[model samples]
Structures are given as C-alpha cells and as structure tokens.
Target: MTQKKDTILSREIGKLGGFGARLVAGLLPKNIFELTIETHSPPETALEKAFTILSTEGKVIEDRRIDPNKPAVCAIVGSGLGNLNPALVEVYVVSTKENITKLVIIGTAKEGLIKQYAGEKAARRIADLLTQVLP
Candidate 1:
C-alpha cells in the first residue's frame, strides 16, 4: 500500500524509503494495521470465529465476507462513529499445506483525522476478539 507524500504517514514511511514522485489525484490516505497470528487451524475455522465475534458486536456494520479460500471478512464499526464512518476492519486467515495458519488483520481509515484513530481502535478490537476466541 502507498501513502500520500504530503501526509504525515507518508513522510514517516518515506523516511524508511524515499518517495517516488507520484501524483495525488487518485490517492487516498489509509491508516493500516497488520498482525500475523500463528494458529493450528484451517481458514474456515478462523473465519467462523471472527465472523461470530464481529456479528455479535453492536458496533459492527457492513459486515461481510470477502473470500473463504483465504477466509477474509470486513466490517465497518462504531469505533466512535456511526454507519457513515469509513473506519474498516478486515481479517484474513491464510493457510499453507502445513498445519500453521496466519491470521492477518487490517484497519483502514479512508478519511478524517479522528476516523483514523477509530480505525486503529476498531482493528485492535477485532484482533483482540479473534485472539481470545480462536485457538
């Protein structure tokens, strides 16, 4: 994922790697969070657990599964905002031939300053719930 050079996040990521002079016309700022969880489970099992947790939460909105092969789901939740908030949390359970499975969770805030914070918080909640529920 790429960040806008003018934004604070882009400047920070830029320090790690120099920015490529790209136009900002179609660029959108996204606050992303990632986690890799080690589990001895299948993608379906992990996806089920995450779906249950998010669906049970009242804050969750637009909760839907993106894919089952990779077993990914996304939801927009009330991380201090209503349905209109762009704060999105996406969880993916990826598995290889081995028994190990990697659960990746990402939070995206497409707009607003406070929404960015909300996106982070929403991501944390999803990760925490998955950790507590999944084996």
Candidate 2:
C-alpha cells in the first residue's frame, strides 16, 4: 500500500493561521510536518474529537478555541512535562478525507522543538498518536 501523507505535513494545513505561524516561527519545517487531515469538518467539532484523543494521554492544560478568521479551525494548548516552562505546546486538528483526522503539534520550545520533534520519524509518531486520538 502507498504510504499516506501525514495530514499535518500537507499543504492544506499550512494554509491555517496556527500552522502557518508555526512554520514561519521555525518551530516546524515544511517537509517535516503537514496536515494529516483536510476537509469541511469544522475546528470546534473537530476539537471535541481531538480533546477526546488528547485525553487518552492525560489532561490538557487549556481548553480549545477556533482561529478567529478560521472558526472551523481549532487548536489545543498544553505543556510537556519537565520542560523549562509549564506552558503546553499547541496542537491543531483539522478534518480530512475518509473521516480521518489531521494533527499538528507546535513545540513550546520555539527554538529546538522542531529540530527535536519535527523529524521524519517524529512526524510518524505524532501521526500515529493523532490517528488514535481522533475518530
């Protein structure tokens, strides 16, 4: 079977403000990350599903919200344990083909997070977790 392109790495996600900003922030690389899902699914509804997925790991630091310009767009913010700052990284979710979900996580580190987490293999890890988290 052909390997699927992680939606978080897709061009469609770059179109999002959060994703676009993260990309420019150098927190993630273009090829390293893409939208694992892209569809008409709104961010609010999508976030409900995403939070369910995130809950599988543990409680998130904050609630979800939609991008003002992209209401359908939603993001989850929380911090990783043991990091210098307790602030959570941002993870964005969007809808895609076949009802699958797309996942994009912004590292809170801002400087080394991408280098540490945005690698090819890291993307796969994030994708797999996202797949389990979303419907």
Candidate 3:
C-alpha cells in the first residue's frame, strides 16, 4: 500500500460523508487510519484478500458487505493476547478513471486505559496489516 499525507482527503473526510466527521472526530483517545489504493480488482476480491491476510495475523470475527448495492465491506478482527486488540475495518471500492478501482479503507480501534499503549499500537498494527492486502 502507498502511504500518503493527503490534505485534500483529510479536509473532505472532515466535512463530508454521511458520517459528518463523526468517524474522524477525536473523543477521548482513538486510533484511526485511512488508505486509498488504486487497482483493477473487484470489490469482493479485495475484501477476500484482506480477510485472508488479516486471518493469518489475527482472528476475523465479521466479514460482510455494508449494503447489498454498495461495493463496501465492514470487518472486525482481533489479535494479540487472547484477542485483546480488535480492529474495525471498512473498505469501499470505487471505480476511478476508466478501469481502475480505488479501494478506500477506514480502520479504527479503541485504546483501553488499563493497557493504553498496547491497545493503540495493536490497533494500528491491525490497520497496517490489513492495508497491505488491499488489491
């Protein structure tokens, strides 16, 4: 996955989407990351690949489409120490340009006060791992 510090995306995410910045808002402590990958892959193909990659490193609890008509999937995976760290990942596939598909990934996880450091790190790790598998 390509890493970027996209100011435009940051702005749009804060002002747009039905989420209305709720997903991007900071409350207490939150670990969140987003990735946009362009490929010529199908939505289900990318979703399956992400699930397989995450499963190798963690236990995937949920893998389902957010809506029947939308090319989006939401999955939750747990890893590390009896699955103490769990990550919620949302992937949206969009057709960009002529034939390229752009996969938008949003991942989030909570930071527990008891093990504050571990929680955030593990959560981001899950996001990083999942990003590598996006088609």
RMSD of model 3, in Å? 10.8
Q: Which stretches of candidate 2 lie over 4 Å from their true place?
A: 1-36, 66-87, 93-103, 109-126, 132-135
Q: Which TM-score value belongs to model 1?
A: 0.61
- The TM-scores, one per candidate, come to 0.61, 0.36, 0.50
In model 2, state the lDDT of residue 123. 34
Q: Candidate 3's residue-wise lDDT over 1-135, tens digit each?
A: 121223222332344333544354333254566766766656667666766765665445445643455555554545335654454555566555566667666665544355434334544564466556544
* Better lDDT candidate (1, 3): 1
- lDDT by residue (31-105, candidate 1, tens digit) is 566776767766777777877877765234333445534456665554635543335566776654578778787
What C-alpha lDDT do the candidate models reach, one value each? 0.58, 0.40, 0.52
* Cα lDDT for residue 2, candidate 3: 21
- Sorting all predicted structures by lDDT, with the top scorer first, yields 1, 3, 2
Better of 2 and 3 by TM-score: 3
- Residue pairs in clash, model 3: none
Candidate 2 CA-lDDT value: 0.40
